[model samples]
Target chain A: MQRIQWFKWLSLVLYGIPMLLVLVFPFIVMVSTSFKTLEEVSQIPPTFIPRNPTLENYREVWNIIPLADHFRNSFLLGVGETFLIMVLGVPAAYALARFRFAGRQPYLIFLLVTQMFPAIVVVLGVFRVVVALGLLNNLAVVATTAASFSLAFCIWLLVGYFSAIPPEIEEAAMMDGDSRLGAMIKMTLPLSWPGLVAVGVFAFMDGWNEFLFSLTFISNDEMMPLTVGLFRFISRFQIQWHHLMTGSLLATIVAVALFMTVQDKLTRGMLAISEK
Target chain B: MSVVVCKELVKRFGATVAVDHVNVEIQDGEFMVFVGPSGCGKTTTLRMIGGLETVTSGDIFIDGVRVNNLAPRHRDIAMVFQNYALYPHYKVFDNIAYPLRLRKRPKAEIEERVNTVARMLGVQHLLDRWPRQLSGGERQRVALGRAIVRNPKLYLMDEPLSNLDAKLRVQMRREIIHLQRNLGTTTIYVTHDQVEAMTMGDRIMVMRAGKVQQIGAPEVLYNHPANLFVAQFIGSPAMNAFKGRLETDDGKIVVATEFGRFPVGDPLVARLKPDRSPTLGAREVICGIRPEDITLDDAPVTPASPQAQVDLVEGLGADAYVSLTIGGTTLIARTPADCPPAENQLVTIHLNPNKLHLFDPITEETLLALP
Candidate 1:
């Protein structure tokens, strides 16, 4: 048994290190490049670690562009999309989870079918709608678009979470003198808190990292999120690889931190429907 | 207190009928139990009266008010589910006090009522604990406290004690009976255990295949079952049945079976339908008798006693069940544990002639109105 244990761990280290390095290599590159000077970043035989470590890239990256304004735009878009997805998704998911009606199976299939196609496939149609509404370059338009794209995913996840809870809890509440709506708010919502937080975190991350729709919809520099704002560093001339890496690293840390906090609940919520 | 009347209640799930036109009127403060095997519509009937399931076509009246259209909350009833359904997020105090809080009762009243119920159910010490922290029996007590706290018009319990261990089930059974007696509230209970139904109900309703087979006081059911199903279903060591034909042996009526012939007493013959008495000759019938009615004696109790070979003996402290067979026909006879016959020993089995239950071969209905 001891020999078998030693062999198993040896195999894990042999296989796991390369797989892990593949995942974390980009973050390491971003960190190392963000601490390098402009000349050091452009070196042909680039040093994996900085030869002369400095915070010059971080200081220059902020001064060169409206990085603070970009931060605010991304923050607003994430919070906006999360709020909209939860507000619309909670009730829709609850209805799908609890109510029995004709075409329910078909409707669930339709929700899945909505998620099968990529957003790029319908980007033209969405762009047409945005132009017709005369909301070009609007942050609200970008947030709304991102929210619509992820609504199906949010609803599907929340339906699983809500369905995981025993319906008898709500039925017991109803028997105890609460209306159907009242029972839902009191019994079902409290039990589904973990699921709600998981879905909200996912929606926030989706909006925070979103690029395609924001690029297509928003043109103004002040309204641009980090995804498009980071592009200003790249010109028809030389690209500022040091400043670009610094901004990308900053944006990634926010999303990673949020994900780490709710990692436990998120896995459970996702596993709920699959387990069923 | 309220009187609940279900008028021709029926529930259908698509092509299958779950409850087939059940009609029962529960008296005020009566304890009515619906007992049956799985898929027998007992739970469905209870759910319909609780307003959880919609009635396909029927009327449910509570205290003279037709509540078919009313919501469950409006109907003013409390139900204890099989799993107890306690709010895991709430503490024991809040779980019991939820109904009053929903009704917007004053803080002092809610606290007082919750405390009173907790004391009554012996859960006052666990008031601060969550449901997950409590044991199965404690959780069951909390569920009971929640049901009784509101003083609702009626209580509907769906196998509330089924999840507990056997010892806890019996203790809770007695406690529920005592609590119901003191409260004097009408309650409808559903369970598949015949022992629970027999012991707990003021009137037990036995159902099968979405239909009620019999409904009466427990004694009435045990003494005079409406049909073959109840006769066999009610007793623990189920009533033994033997296929036989009624015939005249030397000018005396007797049931002749493959094992042997036994004379049918005059009292039993008088209880049979008078109109069919003339045609009773050579009529095939099922002879049913409870285990307790069949006595195993060392010597023949009567001149015509049939001797049986004891196949197995199961002792239960006070009494023992002896499985006796004669000519391939097996019958269980109850005998004193101290003097049980040894295995494979020959014993004279004397079936109490007066206690015999006769059923028709085709319809399976009782041929004699047992006195």
Candidate 2:
């Protein structure tokens, strides 16, 4: 047993450390750059740690861009996107999983086909529609765009998740004096908590990090989400690398913190589908 | 009175008829069991009555009210599913109390009734436990408690004990029967096991190929099956069947079979009644006899007793089933365990004339009735 434990430790060190470094090295660089002086950020052969760490970058980043407004915009967009995705995707998924209807196969295939195209491929056409509708600079438009992109995947994942639970659970509830809708609310929804959490997390993350749609639709600096607002530090003349790194680091931390709260349920939901 | 009546009830799924013109009236407090092989529409019939499945045609009446369009909840029925269907997230107490809570009963009433049911099922200790923490038997008891708590007008169980082990099934079978007797609530249970149907039901309805084959009391179904299907299905190890011809030998009617010739008695012929006699002219027939009716005892051997070579012997604690073959025809005979004949031993076995059943080979309908 001791030899096996030693072998396990050796293999982890050999393979795990390099993979961790490859994934986390850029975040480390962001953290270092966020704390470094402006001059230290530009030094040749950049140091792994800042020689002189300062809070100046963090202080000046809010003043450089409307960081508070961008945070609010991102928060609103995430809430709106998550709400829309769940309200629309859950019933569609339940119907897909539970009911038999004409053209269900074709409709599911259509959802799959929609997922194949990246946002870049449809941005021009969407921009034209937005221009025609006079809906530019609208945060709701950005939220809706992001939600539409992830809705298909949300329904697809939940269909498998919901189908794994036996239908007899709901039938028993109905027999126990609940209506069909009530049975779904009391029995099916609670049983699907993990899958719903996973879907909600995905939608929130998509809205929080989306850039192409926000940049195209919201030209207003005050209305821009964090993803687009961070771009203000970049220009043709020069780049405010210190302030940009500081802002990006904060955004990453917020996203990571939100994810940490739901990762347990998210992994369980995904595992349930994969096991099936 | 909680009488449930189904008149020509039918359930058709697209191209296939799952239940065909089934008509049954369950009296108040009757424990009715539907028994059949798998895919025989027994479950479908129970589901239709429970309003889980819609009727393709026909009407269902509960307490003399037309309930064809009523929902399951509105119909006042409780069902125990085969897998127990306990809510995994709820504690046992909450699982049993949920139905009462749904009806918006007083909080005190819900609590009192849930506790009462928990005590009755002997699952009071498990009230705080989730379904996943309990054993299969405990889960089954919790499910029963949930169904019993509401005291609905009718109870429907879809093979509730099929998942239990043999010993647990028998124990649960007795508990359910005792519970039903005490409650005196109308119930319709569906199962494919004949033994369960015989033991639990006040009346058993047998189905095959989407049609009810026979419906009668346990002893009636056992002693006088309407057709070949019920005759073979109702008994364990099944009844021994032999293809033979009705022929007169020395002015006495006898069934000439491959095993041997057996004299047909006058009462059996009289029960055939001349106008209803389908085998008047020495026509081909199928004769059946219960294993217990064939004696393997070494008593005074009569002339007509057939000699069979014992091929196998299976001894139970008090009885043994001996597999015997005569002229390539196999017949199983039950004998006392202490007097099991040796394998390959030729034994003279007397088949009781009163217990012999005759069936028309072409129609597969019983030609002889119980006297």
Candidate 3:
């Protein structure tokens, strides 16, 4: 028993060391680079830690660009757009999962086909529409298109979660004097919160980090999200390395914090699906 | 007067008919059971009455009012699902009190009703726990409480005890029956188990292939099965059946079966009115009798008693199932436990009068219904 225990620890360490390095090493580099001076950042031999740690990059990135507006835009677009997708997606998924339609299987395949189009390619077509619709320089346009891009995958994940629940639960609710809609609200929706949260988190993250659409579609600086705002530190000649690194590091921390809050939900949702 | 009336109710899924024009009237406060094999549309019928499944082409009447277009909640019916269907998130109190809460009943009344039901089911202490925390039996009781709290006009149950172990199922069977008797609410229960059908239902409706084969009291079904389906489906261990020829010999009717040549009685002959079925006279007929109705005498006291070879004996507390072969056919006889014949032993068995049933092989219709 002692030998087995010892062997198990050996295996964990063997597997854990490289995985931790691959996962955590880049974040450490980003943080350390964000604090270093320009010369130190571009030094001949790269240092793992900043010898002369400073907060100048943080102060400059805030002042140089409309960084605060970009931050606000990212959140509004991320959370607001994600909320819209959920309101629309969960019901569509429920119908697809629970009810039968003439072209359901083919329609699902078609939704998946929509997911395969590259964001860059789709953004070009969307910009053409934006020009025709006179919606240029609109943050809403960026949020709407990004949400549309993420909608199909969101519905697909939710369909699995909804379909896993027995229809009997809803039927029971109805028999308990609830309307059909009420039954869904009271029974199916609550049971599927974890899956719904996972979808919300994904859409939010996609909206937050979205770059190509926000860069090309919204030419106005005030309307730019963080992903595009991060580019203001780069010019034709030289990149402001520390400001860019500091901006990215801040974004990463926010994403990490949000993910940490909902990682339990994500695990729970996946576990619910996998259970027989 | 009947409290529930389902008239020519039909449910068709695409080209397949799930319920083929069923008609049944349930008395006020009666416990009516629907019994059949799986996919025989018993659950579908109950679901239709509950308004979970839509009425494809028929009208349902509760208290003589047409409820075809009424929703489940509007119909004022409560249903206990086969899997309990208790909410995983809600505590037992909230789960049971949900119906009252939905109607916006006063706070104190909801609590009172929930408590009353909890105490009735002996789950008052567990009322604060979530459904997943309870055992299967506990979950089943909570499901019952949820249904009973509604005090609806009708109750529908879809094999609600099928999930429990055998011992618990028997115990719950009695609990439900007792509860239903006290409540005196009209109920329609669906089950595939003949024992539950016989024990719980005031009347049993035997169904096969989406059509109701028989609807009558349990004793009526056992004594006078409307058809072969009811004869075979209504009793435990099933009725012993054999292919045979019905012939008149020496002014007596006798069934010449591969199992044994047994004497058929006047009551069965009079019931068949055999002279009317000239085609049925020469054709093969099915002879059925309940297992308990067959008397075995290993040491024959009569010269005319038929002999059988016992192949197996399964002893229960009061009786043993003695599987025997007579001539070339096999049949199970319910024998006294103390006198179970040893395997492969020769024994003499006699059929009881007034209990013989005959069915036409081609049609499988009871001869009693022939004329």
lDDT of 3 by residue, A160-256 (tens): 9999888998999898889888988888887887787778888888889888888888888889888899997898998888889899998888778
Q: Give the TM-score of chain A in candidate 1.
A: 0.89
Each prediction's Cα lDDT score?
0.89, 0.89, 0.87
Per-residue CA lDDT of model 2 for A1-276, tens digit only, reads: 999999999988999888899999999999999998878888898887889889999889978889999988998899999999999999999999888778999999999999999989999999999999999999999999989999999999999888988889999999999898998888888788777887887888888888999999999989999989998888899888898999999998887887788687678765653432
**Fnat for each predicted structure, in order:** 0.78, 0.74, 0.78
DockQ of 1: 0.53
Docking class of 3: medium
RMSD of each: 3.2, 2.8, 2.8
User: Interface root mean square deviation for model 3, in Å?
Assistant: 3.0
Per-residue accuracy of model 1 over A51-102 as CA lDDT, tens digit each: 9999877788788778888888898899999999999999999999998888
Residue B103 lDDT, candidate 3, scale 0-100: 95
In model 1 chain A, where is the ten-residue run with the lowest total lDDT?
A267-276
User: What TM-score would chain A of each candidate receive against the reference chain A?
Assistant: 0.89, 0.92, 0.91
Fnat for candidate 2 (0 to 1): 0.74
